[model samples]
Target: MNPKELALKAITDVFVRKDITAFDKYFSKDYKQHNPFIPNGTEALKQFLPTLPKNFKYEPGVITDHGNMVMIHGRYENWNGKNMIAVDIFKIEDGKLVEHWDVMQEEVLPSQSANGNAMFPII
Candidate 1:
């Protein structure tokens, strides 16, 4: 599989399944994740990822590969409970995800939702 496809699969199996050991197989030990709630690094991710409610979806957009680095745009929401559009940047080093950066906002339903704009960067 291509780097992008492999990355997506890793996310699906590791994150969705809450399999911490998957990181060793699919991600680099130096993996760095920047997200709203999480601090940093794979260890932090291992701690935070499992705490989130199940069924959080990752709808990856066109994965643009800059050689080994890939930029992914996706929407992450836990069913009807909460919604957030997330921007995740993945860097593949030696075929494994070595770095990750992400940002997310609470979904804003124009009139009903409390948060302002769920879609960030309006990209």
Candidate 2:
């Protein structure tokens, strides 16, 4: 799969579907994570996934690819009792994800925004 497709599938399988096998399929053994809350490596992610609240949900939005990197803008619902908006960036190599980075913030309701702009596009 292309980098974008790989990224989407990886996120869907691991985060949305909670498929542990997806880690071996989509990620390199030495996968590097920039998220401080999670340790480096696919095994660490596998362990982390099951600890999430059962109501946790991931909603992917706009996605873009540049070279071997893919960036997905998404929302995490019921994450630690609050919703979050995040941009997840993945680096693909040899048909697998080698590295990841993310920037996340608590999602604010549209009504709370001074300009009333949504964090994610309204598509």
Candidate 3:
């Protein structure tokens, strides 16, 4: 898969579907994570996945590609009704995701945004 497709599938599997088994297929063995709360490798994710709140949900929005790097924007809806808009960046090498970084913000009302639209991409 190209970088964008690789990122989309990887993110959708792990985040949207909440499946860690997909990790081996999509991630490089040396996968490095930049999420502060998470540890350094794919194995850490395997350990952490189940700890996530079961009610949390991830819905992907737009995906952008930059050669070996891809970024995906999505919504993370938690159990308490609090929602977050997040952008996750992945670096792909040899068709496997090798590194990742992410940024997230709490979802806000349209009035709270300067353009009166949600943070996620409309497309």
Candidate 4:
């Protein structure tokens, strides 16, 4: 697979599926992840994958590849759960993931949650 495909697959198939072996095949042990949540290393991914609700699914809208790096924009949906708009950035080297960052926000309407006329910008 291409670097971009491998990177996304690592997250979707490996991390999201709680398949740690995916990391063994796709991640560097020295991987460093920068997220508002989640720790560093393969173990962080290992621990985090299971935290997501099993019904979750990501609906990708955009995937921009810049050489060894990729940026993904998507909406995460669960049938009866919260809806999330997410943006994730990934850095890959030699078909293995080395760094990752993401921002996930709950979907809210003009008068429902925050963001309707919120002061805090979506960063």
Best by TM-score: 2
Question: What Cα-based lDDT does every candidate model obtain?
Answer: 0.69, 0.93, 0.85, 0.73
CA error at residue 16 for candidate 1, angstroms: 2.9
Measured with C-alpha atoms, the lDDT of residue 24 in candidate 1 is: 74
Q: Pick the candidate with the highest lDDT.
A: 2
Query: lDDT score, residue 46, model 4?
Result: 73
Runs off by more than 4 Å, candidate 3: 79-81, 111-115
Q: Which segments of candidate 2 are over 4 A away from where they belong?
A: none
Error in Å for residue 56 of model 1:
3.5
Model 1, range 1-123, lDDT digits (tens) per residue?
A: 677876777777765676787777788877776665555557776776677776676565555667777776666677347767666678887878977886666756656656654453354
The residue-by-residue lDDT of candidate 3 on 1-123, one tens digit each, is 789988898888987787898799999988898999777778878886777787888888988888898988889888246898888899999999999999988888788888898676555
lDDT of 2 by residue, 1-119 (tens): 99999999999998899899999999999899999988898777778889999989999999999999999999999888999999999999999999999999999888999988889
Residue 52 displacement in candidate 1 (angstroms):
1.7
Q: Which stretches of candidate 4 lie over 4 Å from their true place?
A: 78-81, 109-123
Give the lowest summed-lDDT range of ten residues in model 4: 114-123
- In terms of lDDT, model 2 sits at 0.93
All candidates in order of lDDT, best leading: 2, 3, 4, 1
TM-score winner, 3 or 4: 3
Q: What ranking emerges by TM-score with the best candidate at the front?
A: 2, 3, 4, 1
Error of 3 at 64 (Å): 0.5
